[model samples]
Target: MSRRYHRKSRQFMIGDTLTIPQDKPDIEFLLRMTAVPTIDKATGADKKVIFSGHVLVTIEYVACVPDGTQPIHFVSFEQPFTGAISHRSARPDRSIHLKGLMEVQELQLVGPRQVKTSLQLKVCSVKLVRCRSPLPTHAGEA
Candidate 1:
């Protein structure tokens, strides 16, 4: 007797344009991705098919603080974001390619104590390839 097996191929793509805003005028800003994984806090067993990553945002600007008025200051922080994609499982074998572009949309100052900025984040592409192994392995064997 023999069993029937299926061979399937799936290619998922993700694309979007994001409008980001800031409270202060930043001369420059840099975004760095820290980690990418499956099953973010927002999606759990819902079949929503979501992907998430940790981003580090660094901003350089001028601000006035209680200590004194500074001409330049550097601020850095981490943020987590989630994006929807075609339903797929997050596994080691799965191939994921992510790319993004950032640009300054608008910049203004509300008052002497406050600054406003608008940023645009364009997600060029996020591609994932789903595949499976045909063999089984035991825990004790390598």
Candidate 2:
């Protein structure tokens, strides 16, 4: 499915998978504003959020802290609904997980960040993976 997020007069359209990285201190929160899935780490306890169908992935990033002590802050947004299931599952967060050791170009992928301002960043890499849906059922449930 196709979706859009409007922030600071900029409209970002991210479909399937999107990657973004930051290496400088500037924008502080994932493109000023965006909608991201709420991960109920408590009761949800779902480290792996299995999604299917057409998924809209949005990767937002904030400016990196000057010091290397604090890890850069980045968040992924996903809006998925029932559709043709062409892609099955998409995890923009995985790109964050796979950071510090890869590059979008090396992975044959590109991030959706403004090149003009994004220049401040030394982005190592960003990645988005498309795969089939997991077992369409809850854990321990038949």
Alpha-carbon local distance difference test for all models: 0.37, 0.26
Off by over 4 Å in 1: 1-49, 63-70, 86-93, 103-105, 111-113, 130-142
RMSD of each: 12.2, 16.7
**Model 1 lDDT tens row, 51-135:** 4543344444555545555557555444455565443344445544444334323434444433344444433223334445322
Q: What TM-score does model 2 achieve against the real structure?
A: 0.21
Top model number, lDDT: 1
Across residues 1-142, which tens digit of lDDT does each residue of candidate 2 receive? Answer: 4221211111122233333545334443444323322211211112323222222233334454566444445544344332111112323333211111111110112333332211010111122333333222111100
The reply for model 2, stretches above 4 Å from the true place, is 1-71, 85-142
As for candidate 1, its clashing pairs are 23-115
